[model samples]
Target: MGPHIKGKIKKTLSSLAGQSAQSLFPDLFQNESAKAESSTVIVPPPPDMNWLAHADFGEQQKRADSAPPALLALGGKPQQELIAQKLARMGYVVTTASSTAQALERLSANKYRLVFCGADAAFEEVLRFVNRLTTDQRRHIYFVLVGADLHTFYDLEALALSANLVINTRDLPSLELILIKGLRDYEQLFRPLLDILGSTP
Candidate 1:
């Protein structure tokens, strides 16, 4: 072949090799081009109030304002905080107490629809408190006993006799459901009295 034709053949082969390389490593070529284009492009920073501006702050505040108060009479700080947070997430305004005495003080000072007492508190003290409240005919308050293992702490039969409800701490995920069921039970128990009151002048 002539020298000019030979050069043309070589150029054609080089062009074909470039196309083959691009086909074999398409991602590599695309990524390099993308990087180059991105380097020259200007991406504006996200707005500072993006989430806050779009959030339903008014509804959240209204719900917070309307949540009912509940008492968490637990023993350890960690467990108390954990239980309190869980209840708060369920929309209850939770107040935490480390001891039975503190819890009783809070109960006397403020009304609470629900009381969650941990086994860490003296069981006898909790029982006596519950008994006193029952004697006073204050059935509006629903009592629950929190324990890591219910059987480990109290005799199942005795506990069933004393406590309104028993919960295992390990089952924290079900805490909201337990609270709802307890509340429903309390409402059902008092439905007759509510009906009587409604019937009265």
Candidate 2:
């Protein structure tokens, strides 16, 4: 081929290769934008006492001397009373449920930040309640699976679509901690979006 023809062929191949590369790795291109968005963390200044720095994780579990604050409570079996009282001492608003039907009704009527379910409760009942919860575009609540295994339900994506994390009440901060940290990571990753929310508020 002539030199001019060869140069034109090479440019065409380069263009094709560039398009293929982008198709194979769209995230690499988007990551710069993600990093830029994630860099804007601006948490409110900690108390001047620097209490958080000296705070001990073990101390956090210490039974609060004061009544626990309630976020929101789900109604469930009598056994759930244990879950209710536990959260009450931690400062969550405890809602009680004797059955799954009652629990779903409460969710429709109120906004609950955390949901604790009994081991005996029907899984479909819980999933349905969660599905209803997701319809609210305004609130993003965290849900704990409470004693069920991932194996019990293979639909991890479906569960997570409604819940930020799932936990076994028996496990100490295992799934719950993961959920909390995941949320913090999300908040960190979307700090710019948060800034916009705050500004508009």
Number of the top candidate by lDDT?
Answer: 1
Where is the poorest 10-residue window by lDDT in model 2?
149-158
Task: Provide the clashing-pair count of each candidate structure.
Answer: 0, 13
The per-residue C-alpha lDDT of model 1 at residue 84 equals 80
- What TM-score against the true fold does each predicted structure earn? 0.55, 0.47
Candidate 1: regions farther than 4 A off: 1-66, 120-123, 134-137, 151-161, 197-201
lDDT of 1: 0.63
Q: What lDDT score belongs to each candidate, Candidate 1 first? A: 0.63, 0.50
lDDT of 2 by residue, 141-180 (tens): 5455555443222235324445544444444333323333
Question: What is candidate 2's CA lDDT for residue 62?
Answer: 34
